[model samples]
Target: MLYYTIWTLFYSVNFHTSMVIMFSHINHKPFLGAIHDSLSLLFL
Candidate 1:
């Protein structure tokens, strides 16, 4: 159930949008924060 929920949320954003948001976020943060942000994004 949880996995499906996550997948649905991810799909709703789609791939390219996710990548664009991810890179934009990575650009503003420090290295550690970027790593954290990236991991968080991936899980979502």
Candidate 2:
């Protein structure tokens, strides 16, 4: 039971990390674009 619990926790953490990484990657370009646009607008 202890081993199973540990394994489950490990899998959950791994899955969560992968999801975060994937989401960051997916949004990275758009996020950068937004920042650039905002900065340019402020400068203008």
> lDDT of candidate 2 vs native?
0.67
C-alpha displacement of 23 in model 2, angstroms? 0.1
Candidate 2, residues 1-44, lDDT tens digits: the string is 99999999999888755655565567775555655654566589
lDDT, candidate 1, at 5: 98
lDDT of 1 at 30: 58
Q: Single out the weakest 10-residue window by summed lDDT for candidate 2.
A: 29-38
Per-model RMSD to reference: 6.7, 11.0
Candidate 2 Cα deviation (angstroms), residue 2: 0.2
Clashing pairs in model 2?
A: none
**How far off is residue 21 in model 2, in Å?**
0.3
Question: What is candidate 1's lDDT per residue for 1-38, written digit by digit as tens?
Answer: 99999999889668746665677675975556665666
